[model samples]
Structure formats: structure tokens, C-alpha cells
Target: MKLREEDLMDILVGATILGCGGGGSLEEGWKLIKRELKKGRKFRLVDVDDVPNDKIVASPYYVGSLGGNSKDNLAVKSFILLEEFIGEKFFGVVSTEMGGHNTAAALTTAAELGLPLIDADMAGRAVPELHHSVYYIRGYNMCPFSVVTAYEDKIIFSRTRDDLHAEKLVRSIVKVTGANVGVTSHPIRGKIFKRTIIRNAISLAMDIGKSVRKAKEEDKNWVLSLLELGGFLLFKGECVYMERREGSGFTIGEFELQVIEFYLKMRT
Candidate 1:
């Protein structure tokens, strides 16, 4: 699917809804879209099967607190480092999660490197921790991945093949690097990638966005659209209270949604 400039807002809105509480920085997502648009560059969504099996493909995303100036050029720098480490150019990018900023990383990094953005991802929805990814659960090659932060911190994991341990090491580094880093993990062949990745994820997000827009235009209940699209509505209410805390390189919080006569308690 072609990632048109006009489709960006719908995609952002859809991705945010799919984020399930943890896709970062909507403003950053917009900035990325504008930057690539100004360069007369095109952002495309490539089918995963179209990627050459011999080439390398990796997931790139921001990992840290959703605050401050954590969103910037970190992912591009991290990709540069990944290519340097592997001694081969990445063939394409697969987003780590579906969040406003994270999902748009697929577009931004592809434009930055003149590469393809695969229409797939490690997770179909946003997750707070790296270990929650489908890539981690499938037991792919876990070593020699790159982590680069704006603070000039560069760390690579090579010794351990353990995914959980790798996540722990990265969490510690994120803390040391002031709580956020850009990561590109385990570029693998297309055959292996197919086994772990959720397919056609970007297009699915765009569909979600389009549905919401149509619902608004028709003056229909937008939340029902999500249900039609196979999403379960967990709550329907107004936010009564919210609080967040950053610690141990993780953001933890809770919120209350008042559903008329009752309240839905949630945590993340």
C-alpha cells in the first residue's frame, strides 16, 4: 500500500487506537510525516513476501518514557549503527509496535534510508516492554542487535541468546541513558521473519483509521466501528483520574474510567 501524505492523519489516529496504552508521541509521528513529505520522498508499504529472503530485515522503535524530547533522530542513527554492525544494508523496516510514533517509524526510517517499509510488525498492537513482542516469543536470533540513544550511548547485545535477559540488559541501559533509546533488533532472512511477524499490519491500521473517519462523517458512534473491525470495547466512559510514574526504565500508571453508574479500573 502506498503511504500517501493525506493518509498520515488517519494512520496516526488508527495506530493510536491500536496502541492499547503505549505507542509514543503523536506530535513526533506528524513531524516525521512532514519531514519526509518535504523531501519529496515517498513512503510505501511493502508486502512481507516481496522482501528478498537473502536480505536483512529488522524492527525499529523507541523504547522509554513517553515524555520530554525522547522522540528525535534516534531510530535513524540506530539503523546506521545496525548496518555498520552487520556489514550489510537493511532491506526493509518492520515496526515493533502499533503506536502513533512507533508505527510511523516504519515510514520515517524507510524514507531516511531509501528502503522499503514492510507491511508487517513484531506485534499487531502496542506493548510496553520488548519481551512482549512476537519476535521475542518465537525464539529468533537474539544477539548482536543495536541500541542507540541521543545521549551517544551505543550498546550491542551479542553474548546471550536469551530474549528475557536481553530485555533486562536493555532496560538497564535505557535507565543509564536517561530512560529511552532507539533499538534495531535481529535482522533475519525473509523465511524466518514470516514465521514471527504479524502480516499486513500497516494496512490493517489504515483500515482502522478509515473506519473511524467514516464513522465521524456519518455521525455514527465511532466506538462501534472498532467493534465491527474485531476490536473489543473494554470500557465506555470518561477519564476520572490518571497518574503515571517512571522507574526502572519503565512507565507504570493507573486510570479510572467512569462508565455512568460504574467505574472501570485500568493499569499499564
Candidate 2:
């Protein structure tokens, strides 16, 4: 499906919620979307099954803490380098995780490259470490990955000891790159990609976004709409305290929610 600005808004809203407060900021995501739309770029979403089995897809995303001022087009550069290194044209671009920033990153990359954006991702939600991806959990190789920084530093890992080592090595690079970098990795054929990915995740996010938007338009309770969409209302509270810091290439923090109400459902 061809994506419009409204679709991008829905994606931003849904992915932000799915990010669980870790996939960069909503502002950054919107900035990227607006920039692309302003440039007359077109975004397209394709289902996993629609892609030819022989086709190759790659995940392009931003890695590191949410706090950063880097404005370089690192993700696009990483994709270009990876495609050159692999000597294969990518059929589509897949998101590394479902988040405001990363999802937009993948979408913009696809739009810029004139490739379709796959409606799937490695992780259905944002995760802090590379090893948390389904690709890593399923024992998929993460080599031949490209990492590029805003400062024009680039490295392609032809091999790694394991996912853990890859994570460590990337973190070390991130520490020097101002806490963020762009990465493209996990090049897989469509057959294996469909099996390993969190399929239809983008659609799910879009659905959630559409529901909330409809509720708002109808002057209904968006929270109730979310509940109807299979989301649990854990608590309604004000954040009394938050301590966030960028350390070791990760954003570590804790927050306390002073509960105003809590909801629990009983199943029988």
C-alpha cells in the first residue's frame, strides 16, 4: 500500500506507544517523516508474503541511546554501503524494531532508495540490546553488517564471534560516535525473512493508530479505545521521579509512577 502523510502520522503514534519509551523520540520521528514528505518522496508498504522468496531484504535502523544531536543521514549511508558490500540489490527494507524513530528510519530509507518498506520487523517492540532481536534469538548470523556514524566513520563487520560480541563491538563504536549510529544488517532472503520476523507488526501498529485517531475524531475516550484494542490499562499516574542517563552506549533510567488508579481484569 502507498503511504500518505496520514499513514505516517498513524505510524508515528502507534510506534511511539509500542516503543515503550525507548525508540527515540516522537519529535525526531515526525521530523524525518516531514522531511521526506516535503521532498515529494513516496512510501510503500508490502506484505511479507507478497515479496518473492528469492528476493533479499535488509534491516536499516539507528542504534544507541535516545539522547543525541546527530543530524547525519547515517541509516541511508549504511544501507548504501551494505548493498555495495553484499553485491546484491535489496528488494525491500525492513525495520529493526517497532519504534517511532527506527520505524521512521526504515521507512525513510526505503523511500529514499525507492524500495518498498516491508510490513515486518525484527522485534515487534523496542529493545535495548541487539541480542534481544528475534534474529539473534533464532540463531541467525549477524555478520556482514554495516555501521556508520554521523562523523563519516564507517565499518563493515564481515564476521563476529556471536551476537553478544556484535552488540559489544557496536556499543564501543557508539560510545565514540556521540551515542548514536546507523546500522544495516541481517540480510535475509524473503523465505527466511518471513519465518523469522514479527510479521504484520507494522499493520498492527497502523491499526492501533487508526483506532486512536478515529476515537479522537468521534470525541470518544482514546484510552477506552486502546483497551478495546487488547491493551491493558496498567495504571493512571503522574511521574513523580525520573532518573535517566546515557551510559555505555545505552540509556539507563528509572521512573516512579504515583498511581491514581489501577485496573485489573478477571478471567474465569
Off by over 4 Å in 1: 68-71, 232-235, 261-268
Tell me the TM-score of model 1.
Answer: 0.90
How much is the lDDT of residue 7 in candidate 1?
76
In candidate 1, where is summed lDDT lowest over 10 consecutive residues? 259-268
Q: List the candidate 2 regions with Cα displacement exceeding 4 Å.
A: 266-268
Candidate 1 residue lDDT tens string, 1-268: 6777767778777888888777887787888778878888878778988988788898777777776344567777787888888898878998888998888777788887888889887878888777777767776655678888777777777666577778888887878777578888777888788777899888888889999999999999888787788766566578999999888787789998878543244332
- RMSD versus native structure for model 1: 3.6
Alpha carbon lDDT of residue 138, candidate 1? 76
Candidate 2 clashes between residue pairs 3 or more apart in a chain or in different chains: none
Clashes of each: 1, 0
lDDT (0-100) at residue 5 of candidate 1?
74
Instruction: Assess every candidate by TM-score.
Output: 0.90, 0.95
